[model samples]
Target: MRSYLIIGMCVIFLIQYFLKLQWLEYTVVTLSLLAFLGSTLKADKFPRWLGIIMMTAGLLIEWNKDTGIEGISEGIFLILPLLSLITLSPLLSIPLRLGGYFNSISVLLRNLLLHPKKLYAGISGTLFLLTPILNLGSVRIINEFLEELKLPSALSAKGYIVGFATAVMWSPYFASVSLVLLYLNIPYKDYIIYGIGFSLLSLVIGNVLFAIWEKRHPLTKEAGVKVPLEKQHQKQLVKLVFFVILLIGSCLVIEHITNWSMIVIVCLVSIIIPLIFGIVSKRWYELIPRLVDFRDRTVSMLNNEIMLFMSAGMLAFAMKGTAAANGVSDFLTTLAHQSVLLFAIAVMVIVLCITYIGIHQIAAVGALAMQLNAVELGISNISLALLLLLTWSISTALSPFSGLNLMVSRIAGVSGVQTGLRYNGLHLFIIAVIGIGVISVIG
Candidate 1:
């Protein structure tokens, strides 16, 4: 029953976004929150309670403010990322499993192991490159490899965080990009170009900082042998590489021609590419049943994301009609007037500070990027967006409370604080400065 309900929401969201149906979108958004609220009531421990608090605050604030039909309709689209991921997740898992991509990763790692001197750089670079293709799936693969080697968790956690965080900073398919595009209302292609440039800058700085850390605290024990990717996997690996590129290229072209959002475009291409691949390779018959079997668990995986995003939307809209909104806007405007460059730097620090206190970066970013009104920031919207994305990715990476941080810590077998902050804090700060510089240069 939960499986069906989850699947139902996924379908509604795709339909709602694709058709641009305001009424239906809000209907689905409302339903999704209610369903999640029901589940939260039953299981109050862990991060589940965070969503409940957000949802409750959203409700009370919205009740007083009354964001009518239109505001309600607009807020509904904020869940686009959740819905897009759901549609893409099952479709994506099929290729990672059946296509050579999964095994190809092991092959790549094996090669990295051969060049032991460059191993950290190689692993970090590989993760940054593969994250858009694999998302958290990359973490699973890395974790499996790390666990087999009996490497200490703390050693690899910072590298993993850097790799994955860079992916979120720039990828068109990442939720951060989707949210940025949603509010900025700009061509994703423009942001993609800027994002790529800044992301590279951040990576270069992060890797150098990481190398320094490695020098200061060398690995205590040897990383034992890893099995290399074999010939059979190599044959499929080429095919996997070709298709992943083709998939991304096709989505960009289709978006250009149709003027659809990246989320919508990705959802469409993710489904189409694999379907065609499965059929042409004569694997559709086998693949379809396995994908169907996996649906139950795959759909259930969205619990936290759906809850936070939907409630955040409501919270954002409700804030618009509150005095607190004006106060925040005024403060930001005054700060911006003082210095856009300094303001950008301050934004990064504030995001990290707030994250330390347990506020989700998404909540703060959505508020900053979406709700702040009438601030004479003297920064180009694109520059502002780059600043926001930089802070969002870096803060989330360093925040122990963030989903990404917790998952990485769990998989790497380190405490979240150790991995998320103790190890990566200064590295992330340097990256933040680089990110601001990149934005300033572009502006």
Candidate 2:
């Protein structure tokens, strides 16, 4: 029931984008409200309870100011695109899984890299490049391959976690990037150069750090897996790479021509590319059944995200022009006076602290972004976005309660806290410092 409501909201959003009908807009909000009702009770305890509290506070504040119900409606509508992205992006995984794309690539790589160090670098490098396209599916694919190896859990965890988490700094497909872009109202093209540059810098730094860590904790002789690689798997790997490049190029061209929001464009492309591929590859017979399976299983899994984002939207709207919002601006402005670097650091620290306590980083970012005045802070919208993106990327690796770390912990056979704080903590700090310097220079 909840899945249908959420999926219906996404469909209406896509329609409303093209039609620009006021009636459809209201219908989207109505569906959103119904979905929220289910999520508030069904979502995880932390976000579910936190969302309720935030929503209640937002409503009270709006009512007190006499903006009444209309203001509340507008607030919920503000983040509808983000909610749509979360619900729809999972559709990409369907084709990749059914087509055996990741499995083929992982198997081919496993057979080719027989040395432990070579395999480590190969896995990390592949994951870093593919994560922008595959998202968390990239990590799961690599982790499954690693489990068959005689490698230590710590080594494998470090390799994939850093490799996968760093891409969010710039990947347009990442929810973090989308959230920052929406909050700042900065175009993707304006932000892409810095995002890509900083991400490559972070990747280089990660590789160097991983090498250093590897030297101390060396792998045993049995770490290598020698198996005959199939020709078909190699062909599939090449096709997968070509398709990823094509998908990105297509997205850029369409965004330029249509001037649509990146979120909408990505949602459209994600759906279209797979269908086209299925037909072109003569796999059309399996596509509908796979999509139906995804609809039933995956759409229902977004309960926590749905509740948190909708509630965060309400709070962001209610706080606008309020005294509380002004206080946040004033605080950030004072930090800017000292040094813009300090302001960046302060923002990252606040996000880190909030996420460390088990709350998702999106809520922290959504709440603070409403109060951030770019002009007063003496930074362009693009610069602030880069800083926020860095924060989001770093927090994902450091926060034990984060879905990324939790997933890695489960696969790596270690404590969740160890995955974040013990293994990746110091390395993330170094990357954060370097990232801040790059943002300051570019800003």
Candidate 3:
């Protein structure tokens, strides 16, 4: 029942893209609030409590201002598109999963990435390429393969997870990048001009860190099963690469022609490409059952995310135009005028600190973004977008409470805090110095 409500919300949101009806948007907001209520009992303790607090604060603020119920509803509706993007984007993995190519690719990776350092690069590098399309699903797939290959826990944990973080820095498919782009109102092409460079640099920095860490704790025997890489698996690996390029390429081409937002383009491409693949590959028979299974399982799995993001939308609404927001804007403006470098450092520090204490990056970024003015900060909108992307990547990598870290902890048998502080803590220092340099140069 709750799943249906969420699905209905997404369906209605899609309709609004073409129809542009006010009633359709209201329907989405209504369904979203209902879904949030239904999922609250099942959501994780932290998001559950945090959602309640944020919702309460938002409602109280609205009440004090006498904005009435309609005004409050408008606030919640403001971020509904991002929610739809998040909900629908994960469906793209279903066709690939059902096709069984994942097994073939896994076998190929295991046979190839035998040495410890090479394994680290392979794990992180594969995830870097795939995470943009698969999101958290990539982490689960890689970690499942790692369970059979016996590398040290640290190598397994940091390699793939950090790779996932690097993708978040630039990928239009990620909620982090989409949200920042939506807020800043910049074209995806403009942001990607700088973002792709930053992401590539971060990927190299992550691999270099692995090299240093490898010296301290070396693996004597080569990891992974040493079976011959089969021809079929090699073909499957090539097919996977083709699929990623096709999907992302389709999005870029369509966005250029249609001028749709990246999130909407991703949502549409995620669905259309899979169906087209099923038909072309002669696997049309499998699509129905797989899609049904995906719908049933995916929404329940997203209970926490649904609740948290809906409430975050409400809080973002309440925060705008408030005295607190004005004060933050004033302070940030002054700090930027004093020294733009410090302003850049301060942005990353604030985001990292907030996320460290169990606040989701979405919530922190959403709130902090409201308080910022790009003109006053002496930064271009694209540069500001890159700065936020850097912070999102770093904080998501290091925040134990972040969805990525929590997922990694569960798969790698490492505590969430340990995954962040123990593995990525030093990496964070190196990234900070490099990130500030990049921001200084660009901003």
- Winning model by lDDT: 3
lDDT of model 2 at position 169? 81
- Model 2 lDDT tens row, 145-240: 766664577776787778888788877778888878877877787778888787777777777777787688776665454666688887888777
Quantify all predictions' global Cα lDDT against the true fold: 0.69, 0.79, 0.79
Q: What is model 1's C-alpha RMSD? A: 2.7
Question: What tens-digit string does per-residue lDDT give for candidate 1 at 102-138?
Answer: 6666666656653433566756776776677667767
Instruction: Pick the TM-score winner.
Output: 3
Q: How high is the lDDT of residue 434 in model 3?
A: 86
Looking at model 1, residue 356 earns an lDDT score of: 67
lDDT of 2: 0.79
Model 3 ranges with Cα > 4 A deviation: 222-225
lDDT of 3 by residue, 1-443 (tens): 77778888887888887898988877887888888888889998988998888888887887777788787878777677778877888788877787677898677567656577777887888888789878888888877776765667788678866788888878888888888888888778777757777777777888898898888877667534487878877788788888877776777788788889888888787777678867888776787777787689886778788777777767767777789777766777788888778888888888889878876777678776666779878888877777788888888888888888888887768998889889888887787788778777777
Which parts of model 1 are misplaced by more than 4 Å?
18-23, 41-44, 68-74, 114-117, 220-240, 373-375
The order of the candidates by lDDT, greatest first, is 3, 2, 1
Model 3, CA-based lDDT:
0.79
TM of each candidate vs. truth: 0.90, 0.92, 0.95
